[model samples]
Target: MKVKTLEKLAKDMIDYIINLSGFEHIEDIQLNVVDNLESGDMAECNYNDSHGYIQLNIASNMINDIEQAKYVISHELGHILTREFHTYYVNFVGLDDDDMTSICSNVYEQTAEILAKRLGRLILKLYEQKDK
Candidate 1:
């Protein structure tokens, strides 16, 4: 797909998810489709809590089509939705140079991944239903 078309789809998906997910307080969300990410990741989301904004970057070369783009974007959205849980878990358990801390971090990542897959499918289903 073309870059412009991909960007528009991503933006629309983001807006739809935020509106349905009670994330209306988020004032700004920018999408960047880059050639590559320094971390070699498919996508990443950078959120500035103080500014109430999120910068979502997707590696253009990594995504092949609309389905992949939807999944990648929703995964980042999953991170945003689950930030509070991650923070609470980290704060409650405390972070240090320990195996437990590493485990906790892994758990948080896995949680986001799981939520992303489910949320992506749900969003698509709901969107289709709405169209009907």
Candidate 2:
């Protein structure tokens, strides 16, 4: 797909995400399309704690594949959603400072991946229905 088309779709996906339950209170994920990623990954989610905003970066290479792009975006949305909930989890768990680093990263990533794929498919289905 073209960059313009991808941008529109990304906007739509972000809008869909923001309207969801936990995500409604937080900042919407911002889309940043770059020519290439330093890590050589297709995409990743970056959350700025200070500003309370999430940035979703999509590698220019993967933007051509709508499916891949959708997954990347949705996956990052999953991260945002998970991050939001994790904040509450942290309050309850009373985890040690040292343990938090490992637990937060591992647990959230795993959970986000699962939720992203499932939610991504659902989003795509919604799009399909609209198109029909």
Against the true structure, whose TM-score is highest? 1
* lDDT at residue 13 of model 1 (Cα atoms): 77
lDDT of predicted model 2: 0.66
Relative to the unseen true structure, what is the C-alpha lDDT of residue 126 in candidate 1, on a scale of 0 to 100? Answer: 64
Error of 2 at 11 (Å): 1.0
Question: Stretches of candidate 2 above 4 Å error?
Answer: 20-22, 25-27, 86-104
Candidate 1, 1-132: lDDT as tens digits = 466766887778777777888875656677887778897998887755556566888887777888877767766777766666645665686544356458776776677678767766777666546557
* Candidate 1 weakest ten by summed lDDT: 93-102
Candidate with maximal lDDT: 1
Can you write out model 2's per-residue Cα lDDT over 10-52, one digit (the tens) per residue?
7887776566444655445677777778888877877665556
The models' CA-based lDDT, in order, is: 0.71, 0.66
Using Cα atoms with residue i matched to residue i, what is each candidate's TM-score against the true structure? Answer: 0.75, 0.68
Q: Score residue 116 of candidate 2 by CA lDDT.
A: 70
